[model samples]
Target: MRMVFRWFGEGNDQVPLQHIKQIPGVEGIVWALHDIPAGEPWPTDRIKEVKQQADQFGFHIDVVESVNIHEDIKLGLPTRDKYIKHYITTIKRLAEVGVKVVCYNFMPVFDWTRTELFEKLGDGSTALFFDNEKIKDIDPMELVEKISSNTSVTMPGWEPERLKSLAKLFEQYEHVTEENLWSNLQYFLEKVIPVAEQHDVKLAIHPDDPPWSVFGLPRIMKNRDDVERLLNLVSNPYNGLTMCSGAFGADPKNNVPDMVNEFIDRIHFAHIRNVKNKGNKSFIETSHRASDGSVDICDVVKAYHENGFTGYARPDHGRHIWDEKCRPGYGLYDRALGIMYLWGIWDSLERSKKVEA
Candidate 1:
């Protein structure tokens, strides 16, 4: 596995590329033009600029976390074609700059939902928490306020412009059902996957955060069967999955290692984080260590190793350890620790394979 770190950009992220470079085994950055709104074509110059920065640090910009999908595309609105045309242009440009994978999600209204960004754990370190019962009672607007209140660092899915028209956005999804979402997603993949294939860029769709619907929104990418249907829908190597453990682990039914084994080839990027399933559809992101969370992270890595995975992997959301005043889940300390844990597993596996030989 080729490990990468997620860096928001020069001015946006608290963690610097130099710090990321210090992490052993991290070779690249998973980045995005966060200032750009969804649906618009990314400026080629801006893409080159980010690449230049990474080049300065001697890190490859091989993967981008998101090129946010416009609500128009998800809702299958009349204007979707226009946005999709722009998306194709963005993909072509990213490929030109050596980006191999683009990770995005189809979660409506919100990309990921959480009741608390900093729920203090027993160790006094805080992590992103999701309470199943609490989410049902909380008002969507109130949740939006809680997540968006901090204006310094922009949340990926909860952009200010999108939330400014929250009521209207919800209205657009009023008639969208799960089937509608699947059809629209298929429509999107059909148009873009070919372009991605032509440019050697893999379009990786991140599973719905929590792997379930939130706030009455339809979520189609939530379970193993859902992924089976998704891969079959497009049936192309270029159309793939991001294979996020924390997202799928929220649903206890998802055996993350098995999913890794089954779709190993189709998975172009891996978000290897752990989540302690709190039962009844609630979870909290945890340390990448196997004992700290419910997901068997070791087995997950073994599946990838056993399957001969050579794709990009990154340490996903981590605890806000060491009193780090950073983005809710994108803190540097715990994630760097997570990377070492993963490297330990991967290295041990490699040694065992050589011994067998």
Candidate 2:
């Protein structure tokens, strides 16, 4: 497995590429033009700007976290065609900059939901927490305010401009069911996957965080069966998954290692993080250590190593350790620590193979 670090960009992220470069095994940056809104075509010059930044640090910009899907595309509106046309152009441009995999999600209304941005852990370090009970009671707008109030940066999926029409977006989705979401997603993949294949870019969809519905929004990409159905929807090698462990592992039903084994080939990019399930669909992001959270991260890495995974893998969301004043989960300290933990497990696996041989 090849390691990469997600950097929001020069100005948007607190973590610098130099700091990312210091991480032992990280060879690339998982990035995107965060300033650009969803559905808009990413400008060629803007794409080149990020390339120049990564090039300066000798980091390959192989994977982009998203070219976010517009709500029109998800809602299956006629205006979607216009946005999709723009999306196709963006893909072609990203290909020019050497991006290999593009990760995007289809979670309606909200990309990922959480009650508390920083809930204290036993170690006194804080992490992103999801309170299942509170989510049901809290208003979506109130949740939006809560998230916005905490972070200076615009949280992905919870962008203010997008949420401006929050009630309208929810009203539009009132009639849209899970099946409708699946159909809309299929419509999207059919148009873009071919372009992705032609440009040698794999389109990877991140599973819904929490792997379940939030605020009564329809969530189709939530579990093993959901992932299986999505892959089968297009049935092409270019059509792939981002394979986020924290999202899938939060659900006790998902055997993460088993899922890794089954879908390793289809996984083009991996988000390897851990989440401790608090029960009844709530979880808090934890350090990447296998024992620290419910996910068997050690075995998950071993599965990828044993499968000879050549794709990009990144240490996903981590605790806000060391009093780091940074993006909620994109902090440098814990993620760097997490990467080392992953390397520890993977390097040991390699040595064990050698000893066995």
Candidate 3:
């Protein structure tokens, strides 16, 4: 596995490239054009700028966390073709700078939902938390309010422009069912995946966070069968998955390690973070350690190694430790520590294989 880090660029993130360089095994940055809204084609000049910055630190910008798909594409609106053209343009531009994998999601309105951004843990360190029951009772507006309350840090999925127009966005999806979502996603893949192939860029769809419906929005990328259907739909090696443990682990039955082993061939990117299942479809992001969360992170990491995974991997969503005033899950301390923890497992696996040889 080639380790990567997620950096929000120069001013946007508190964790600097200098700090990320200090991490033992990280080789790249999973990044995006944050200021650009969905549906806009990222300018080639801007892509080059990010490339220059990463090159300065000797980190590859080979993986982009998202090139946010316009809601129109997900809704299959008449204007989708226009937006999809923009998306294709962006993909070609990213490829110019050596980006091999582009990670994105198909969840409507919100990309990922959570009730609290900083839930206090037993160790006094805080982490992103979700309470499923609480979500059902609360209004989507209230949840947005809570998530957006952190004005200093921009939440990944909850872009201000989208949040400001929530009512219209929800109304647009009011008629969209699970099947509709699947159809729309297939339509998107059919259009973009071919272009991605032309550019030699792997289009990796991130699994829906929580791996279930939120706010009654249709969620199709939630499980193993869902992934199976996705691969079959596109039927291209470049059309792949960004298998995230925390997202799938929300459902206790996900069998994350098995997923790593089963879909090893098509998983182009990996987000290896652990989450403690809070019961009844709720989970909280936790330390990458196996004991700290429900996911068997060691087994998951080992599975990746055994499968000969040379693709991009990252230690996703670390807790905010040492009173660090950083992005909730993108903190430097816990994630840097998580990298060492992951490397410890990966290196030991390598040693065992050498001994066997």
Candidate 4:
């Protein structure tokens, strides 16, 4: 597996490429034009600017976290065609810049949901935590206000501009059922996948955070079965997955390593992190070590290692360790430490193979 780091941008991200460069085995940055709104065509000039920035640090701009799908497309509205055209344009430009995988999600309204961004653990370090009861009881707007006001850096899924019309967005989704959402996603892939295939770019859909319905939003990409359905929906290699262990592991039934092996061919990117299942559909993000979390991260790493995975991988989310004041899960210290832990597991597996040979 090729290791990549998620870098927001020069001014946007607190963690710099200089620091990320120090992490062993990291090959590139998993990035996107975060300032660009969903469905808008990503400017070619801006794309090239990001390329130049990555080139400075000898990092490939190979994977984008998202080219966000517009709500019009998700709701299957008539105006979706315009947005789809813009998405296609963006995809073609990203391919031109050598971006092999574009990671996107189909989760309705919110891309992901959490009760608290910095829930304290026993170690006094903070990590992203989800409380099942809190989400059910909390008002969506209050949750948005709580999260948006907490951090200046825009969180990946909770874009402030979209949430401004929280009431309206919820209204739009009132009539959208699971089946309707699935059909909408299929419609999107049918149009976009062919273009991605032609340009040698893989459209890797990220699993829903918590991997289930949150606040009544339909989350289709949850487990192995959902992945099977997704692959069959568009039977092309370019139409792939960014299998996130933390997302899938939220539900204890999901065998993350098993799923990794099962979908090896179509998994274009990997977000390898650990999540401690807190029962009743709740989970907390943990360090990348297998021992720290419920997910067997060692086995997950081995699953990819044995397959000789060539796809992009990143240590997905991490705790805010060392009292570091940074983005909730995308902190510098813990993630850097997580990288070493991942490298340690992978290298040992490699050594074992060599010894056997």
| Highest lDDT scorer | 1
lDDT of 4 by residue, 161-247 (tens): 788888999989887898999999999999999999999999999998878888888878888999999999999999999999999
* Candidate 3 lDDT over residue span 224-306, tens digit each: 99999999998999999999999999899899999999999999999999999878887888999999999999999999999
The residue ranges of model 3 lying beyond 4 angstroms of the native Cα positions read none
Q: What's the alpha carbon RMSD for model 2?
A: 0.7
lDDT of 1 by residue, 210-234 (tens): 7888888999999899999999989
Pairs of residues clashing in candidate 2: none
Instruction: Supply the global lDDT for candidate 3.
Output: 0.92
What's model 2's overall lDDT? 0.92
Tell me the lDDT of model 2 at 196.
94
Cα error, residue 70 of model 2, in Å, equals: 0.3
List the global CA lDDT of all models: 0.93, 0.92, 0.92, 0.91
What is the TM-score of candidate 1? 0.99
